[model samples]
Target chain A: MIARVVVVPRPQVADPQGITVARALAQLGFAEVRSVRVGKYLELELDGPPQDADRRIEEMCRKLLANPVIEDYHFSLEEATTQR
Target chain B: MIARVVVVPRPQVADPQGITVARALAQLGFAEVRSVRVGKYLELELDGPPQDADRRIEEMCRKLLANPVIEDYHFSLEEATTQR
Candidate 1:
């Protein structure tokens, strides 16, 4: 299975990286940009049955992939295929 | 408008961070893990009409959001709503 995870900072949390990106965009002439939030996107290839993938991925997010105190994570699993 | 951008390293590129995460997951007892790839996700809030948003976002990605030599990026735009 292939698990795609997205981890984002909680809305109330301040994101300096996002702020910097927004400022940089403005400087680059993208004045339409008002705000930006940066996050992590991970793709994990797992060799396992789909039945337990959700639980396992959830645990992985909580223990390693995401900082529970400040971030929230969600993932979707799809059957792995031979081609990219 | 709101744009969600996903920037990922090209497949041929080496991702040390992803390898480290996979190793850590294994240490944490997630043995089913086969491989991992890490990427960046950015959410941008824009104050403009949706018509020209795609062109502007493409330019932003080419100029600032992604490294053309090493990364590939794609984005989706949606109408911004008042509520979260």
Candidate 2:
């Protein structure tokens, strides 16, 4: 299966990276950019049924894919046909 | 308006970051993890109609959000309800 994961910092967390980019954009004259928050997009292939991938992905995120202390993660699984 | 942008490295580009994570996941015994590709997700707000946001977003990607030589970007815009 092909799994796509998105991990974003919680709203309450201080996003220094985002702030830095915002400042840069402001300096560059992109006034239309009101605000920005950065996150991670990950695509991976796993060997499992859709249900199994979902259950295991949750554990993977909690244990390794994301830092639950400050970030939240979600994923979707699709059948993969391309050879690895 | 709220815009969501996803930027990914070209498939031909070497993604050291993704490879590094894949190796770590393997070491951690998640053998089901076949491969990984890492990218960036950005959420930002702009003051404009959805169509305006789309046009400006394309310019932003060309000028800042992504490097055409190695990355590609796509975005979606939606009406934002909450105050900035």
Candidate 3:
């Protein structure tokens, strides 16, 4: 099974990296850029049945993959016959 | 307007970080994990109309936000009333 997780900074939190990048973009001539927030994307392939993937992913996020306080994670599952 | 860009390692690239992470997960008891890949997520808000955003974001990706060779980027555009 394949699981994809998208983790992003919480809307209310301060994102200094985003601010820095936004400033750079403005200097690079993208003056319309108002804001930028940076985050993480994770893709995982697993050896288990599709049924067990969601629960496992939730546990993974809670245990290690994501910071519960400052980030939010969402995941999607798909069955794959082989690794690409 | 808002643009969310997802940048991920190309499938053909060697992702040593992912390998290391997967190994750590196995040691932490996630034995079902076959592989892991990590990437970047960027959220941007702009001051322009939706019509100009797509081309501008593509240029942003090409010129600064993403490396054309080892990484692939995809972005979504939406109209936003205000920053949250």
The chain B TM-scores of all candidates, as shown, are: 0.94, 0.90, 0.90
* Model 3 chain B worst lDDT run, 10 consecutive residues: B75-84
Docking class of 3: high
Candidate whose TM-score is highest: 1
Model 3 ranges off by over 4 Å: A81-84, B81-84
lDDT, candidate 2, A3-78, per-residue tens = 8898988999988888887777778777878889999988887875667888778877888889999998888888
Clashes of each: 0, 0, 0
Worst 10 residues of 1 chain A by lDDT: A75-84
Ranking by lDDT: 1, 3, 2
lDDT of each: 0.94, 0.85, 0.90
DockQ of 2: 0.80
Tens-digit lDDT track for model 3 on B1-84?
Answer: 989899888999888878887988898899999899998889998897788999999999999899989999999998896566
lDDT of 1 by residue, A1-84 (tens): 999999999999999999999999999888999999999999999987889999999999999999999998889999888744
Q: Which stretches of candidate 2 lie over 4 Å from their true place?
A: A81-84
B1-84: candidate 2 lDDT, tens digit per residue: 988888888999999988988888888878888888999988887875566777778878888888999997788888898876
Name the candidate, 1 or 3, with the larger DockQ value.
1
